[model samples]
Target: MSDDGVRWLDEDQQHHWRALVMGTTLLFDRLDNDLSREHGISLAEYEILVRLSEREGRRMRMAQLADSMAHSRSRVTHTVGRLEKSGLVERIKSPEDGRGVVCAMTEQGWELLVAMAPTHVRGVRDNLVDLADPADFAAVGRVFDAVADHLVAAHPEMEIRGH
Candidate 1:
């Protein structure tokens, strides 16, 4: 195709794409706000807990955690500080490396996550999962998962680790 004649989305496709973008943004916003209001933790905080819960020995190196979560190291640092203040996470000096920090989930954090898990699950079910027909939901998830994987794999220099 000539550069000037390159095809663009049809009007209908553009409109549908925009709608999907807006809806997804709003869905996330609602979930974040709802969790913050109900559980006294922001969505990011909840995610950190989930990640830590899934990690080996319920802990992760700060750098690795940040990379896995696709968060800037500074943002992870700040989030971890907040979690520490809440007695949910504890930072320990890494035994393997002098300059590295390991974030370990405290008992309190585990308990909190256990308590919040149901609520978050319900929120996800209610807001997005329940709204779609089962087959469509599975199809949509698969589509987006492939899209994200391919896009990340294409960007060799991206900071996201093991994505």
Candidate 2:
């Protein structure tokens, strides 16, 4: 209680931190590999499809989409460009604002999402959900929810949208 101000993690804390890092890294790696093999799409592309599908009119403003996906605007632009070439998504000038742009899911994209959802869900359950203790799983949700809240609060200018 009288040190010069660094609160370092002890052995137990270090173990938990490493466990979380390794678990998430491995889980995402497996998920990405599965998606690429089974659907010819990366996990990042699948996430973009899912988000657009969930939006009204299946569209979101470009900047809003980037913020929602935790990607930089330039990165989102590049991904959207790739998706566009794949015929899964399209970009258009926003109807309400001439200078703004929006990304929309195409019919092909929606069809792909419908076909891929089950496989992804099962993979998720097998790899993480079913393996976690029920109570610990609930705690995990709370931890991430709090972290998301803190991040969103800190960056109020990020312009995330419910869509």
Candidate 3:
């Protein structure tokens, strides 16, 4: 390594970071896997539904949706198409922009979200929230906020929504 005075991660910090990442990843893996198996929906599909359900008229512009979901335009397009086929979403021309498209949650999609929200919440609490103490959980929230801010500052052109 270059003799730059920049110090590497301390052993404790490295171990802590690795454990945090691996543990969270494994938790999400199990949650998503079980969710998909039981509910016939993947985590991505659930997130899309949640986004649409929370939007005005359960609708949002394609670009905004992509931003909210942290997905590329093409990936969002493909996923939206699949959701549309499953009768969980609908796509239409944007009223605000002539050349743009929008994604809206359908009646079936709302029903699905309503059905799954409770189970999903339980899975989240069980896998992550309940496992962390209050102080640690608060710290985790702050960490995510800082990370998101850093990312936004680094990539001003990329639309990334935390809310």
Best by lDDT: 2
lDDT tens per residue, model 1, 112-136: 9998998889989998999999998
Sort by lDDT, best first: what order?
2, 1, 3
Off by over 4 Å in 1: 1-6, 154-163
**lDDT, candidate 2, 39-63, per-residue tens:** 9988889999998987899999999
Each candidate structure's TM-score, on Cα atoms with residue i matched to residue i, is: 0.86, 0.91, 0.88
Candidate 2, run of 10 with poorest lDDT: 154-163
User: Tens digit of lDDT per residue, candidate 3, span 1-163?
Assistant: 3389777888898999999899979987877886787788888888889888877799988888887766898898888898999999999998886788989899999998899888789998988899889999999888877786687664322333344
Return the clash pairs for model 2, or none: none
Name the weakest run of 10 consecutive residues (lDDT summed) in model 1: 154-163
Model 1 residue 85 distance off true place after TM-score fit, in angstroms: 1.2
RMSD of candidate 2 to the truth, in angstroms, is 2.9
Better of 1 and 2 by lDDT: 2
